[model samples]
Target: MELTITSQKKTIQANVLQLHLYQQSKVIEAMDKRNNYYYVVFYQDQFINVVKPTHMKRHSHVQRAITNGISLPGDHPLVNKLIGQQTLSMTRFNQLFKKLQQHYPPLETALILSFFDSFTTAGSIPKLIKKTYYDFRRNGKMRKALQALYLLKEVDAQNTFANDLIGKMEFQKYNEAYQTLDIIMEKDPVYFEDICFRHLQDGIYHENLLMFYDQKNRHIDAIMVLLYLLKQQFNETHWQQLQATIQTWNNEAQIIVLSDLYRDQPHPIIEKELTGRLIGSSHHNEVVSFLLEQNYLPTQTEMDKIIDHLNHTDRSQLIQYFHQSKEKFATLRQSITKNQLEKAITPFIKAFLSTYSFEEINQWFRAFHESNELFLIEQTIHTMEKLQDDPDHQDKLGELYASLDQVEQAIDCYKWEMELHPQNTKAIQAVAHLYKEMGNETEAGTYQDLLIQTQKYG
Candidate 1:
């Protein structure tokens, strides 16, 4: 008899196990028990092995053909059918199983089940899954591995052994481990939390996690994780990068988080720096309101730092607020001294000047000069010099210089203004008066003639 072995689209012939059931019929009938009888003999490549009759009960035709000494190919359908029953000896079973595993699709559920069944211990299931997963992964067969993992997960939904393998496969295949994490989280949130904590503790996938959190708009959670990381490891460069990221967010949540961190950590320098950043952000008013509600009074330097970061309109508004608050104004004014007046107090003084009348500003200037604050007087003169085109400002400066006993300088100021505005009777007369004070009668007479000539022309 011949056995037809089909492999894919091809057929071949080989020697298969054959049994003479009639020859053993009398012995099988005469025996008290037929269960222990080995009725068939397999012949392959001049090698022979005995097979049990019960093994082929499911394939009766193949059993009858085997009883007639059939010839079958190595990849015969009967051979595969017999192997699929898992009734062969351990050595032959493993050899045939390995052959099928090597030739068949790795992700085929039947093949996977056959390979899994070959393992004697339940503990080895995870190992088999892991090996199969890596085999597919090594071959760049991500889809196959994912399918295998899904199967393994179905088998053991709480398989902690396969979690890491699945995670790695998902990460490599999808460039994200969250798919695996989500699955794990859904199955066991505590386990997921522990895994995440371990990853964070190991400093693994932190940046990816942060990016994922940001993409999901979980910035507060991301910041909390960053803070935890900083507390655990304290990486200066990483901390700075995190700070820069926080600043880029520049939202109310970030400000609140930073503020809470400051409250908890009590790092005044960091607090001030964070507050300065907040004041510079679009949520500046919100942050300020929060601070005020918390009864947090920023120091003069802190306020100045914030003011320096404001725009022109915001700075004006802030200064107006300061002007209205006597205590706040006093605190601002305490930072101003004669020596540091120009550098430290110029902005404040300018803001004040914008809010007051020119007469009021002049009164302040007179008070500063009378108090022997030479630096303040010099600053006032410098500010007035910027307005030299304004004859009124130039005249004011000239009178100031004359009051300081600077006769030549005052005279030069009037003459400079008269040069700019040749038709100004005030400048011309001032220059003439200064020349008379210096006892230069000829120069005074010259200016008086020029003034009369100007009047005649008019």
Candidate 2:
């Protein structure tokens, strides 16, 4: 006869043929012809083979029968006997599972074992769950392994061994892995520390750890890890990656984290990484001060970068720091343009002009003249007169006087140039022109004769 078993939304069709039982009772085993196996043994409407199927193939049929569909009644004696038993002997558990295997599917067997596994804290359940976990993992069944891991966690949430397994599985799922690691850290900090140190050493999940720390509001820890990584690896690419992470933080956090790093007085490579970033930041003045107070001088390029970001007040403060180290004067000189120097005209020009050779200062004055910086021109002329006595200086002064329409002053400067260098043709010719402009034909003719005599004599 064909029997149809329906349970929940699933239906299974099996042909039940009577087979005589070997024992004395009037019993017959109902074999599913389709499966070629006895699903149940019955005597007077009672099931003798109460053991469920263990193999995967027969789970469907066995499940339907067990669910009040066909094979056994809900309150049957065998059913009550199986339900009342809290724990099974290992031999009995194995036997039942084996017999069920001849009739049910693997999944059903796992479910049965898992149910029993939940009730007992000892015996074969733990081993069976572990085997199941590995089996699923070996078959690339990640979800199944995850389910087993969840069960494992239930049994021992603080089990480092179990947490390790869970962490391994969850690592592939970032959020889940983070949660798992968090739990591990809370329950077993030392173990988590070891795990983290190992992964960091192995260069595994370095970025994930950084992000995890940041997400947990552990900015200092994250920066510490980053610095440690950079110290170990010390490559441009990784430094750039580290910098990108630093960029994500607020200015206050950056200051706190980076200040701690700076305090360590790290290797130059790492120090540059720390200070280089700060040099471009709004906190540049503070960083500059920090470096200076530490006697850790920045290179000129680094100082320039810091100064570029400073406001006028902060810039002056930084420049003052530069003044402390005479080596920084070059940087100060670079920053002092004509306009900037013109602002503090007297002292700055005195200081600026004090540093160069006469030739260098003359060249600078010529540049000022070319750019039509008349204030610098007049100031330079006045400063040079007080400071030097040179024919070139006098000739430049005469040219400046003429450019400013100071005719008599031009005559005086040119005559001085002529006296200082008797064969100064340019200055002599300049004096002649100044005299002609003053309508003094006699003085003009005399200098003209002197110029012709000098030129003819040479």
RMSD per prediction, one decimal?
30.5, 30.4
Expressed as tens digits, the lDDT of each residue in 1-458 for candidate 1 is 22333334444333443222111110010011322333222211111122233333422323433343112333222233233332223134346446546655554422233222322344455566667878887999775566556546544567675555667635464434335765544443323433454466565446655555565564434554676566555566656766776665435545555664554454555566667667667664455343433435566556654444432334454355433333333343455443333433344444554355545545544544534554454465466656655665666777766754467767877877777778888778888888998999999999999899888895
Off by over 4 Å in 2: 1-189, 194-220, 231-245, 251-284, 287-311, 314-325, 331-458
The lDDT values for all models are 0.49, 0.50
Residue pairs with backbone atoms closer than 3 Å in model 1 (clashes): 5-76, 13-72, 13-73, 14-72, 14-73, 18-66, 19-66, 19-67
Q: Please give the lDDT score for candidate 2.
A: 0.50
Q: Provide the lDDT at 296 for model 2.
A: 50
Q: Each candidate's TM vs. the true structure?
A: 0.27, 0.27
The local lDDT score (0 to 100) that residue 126 gets in candidate 1 is: 55
lDDT of 2 at 267: 56
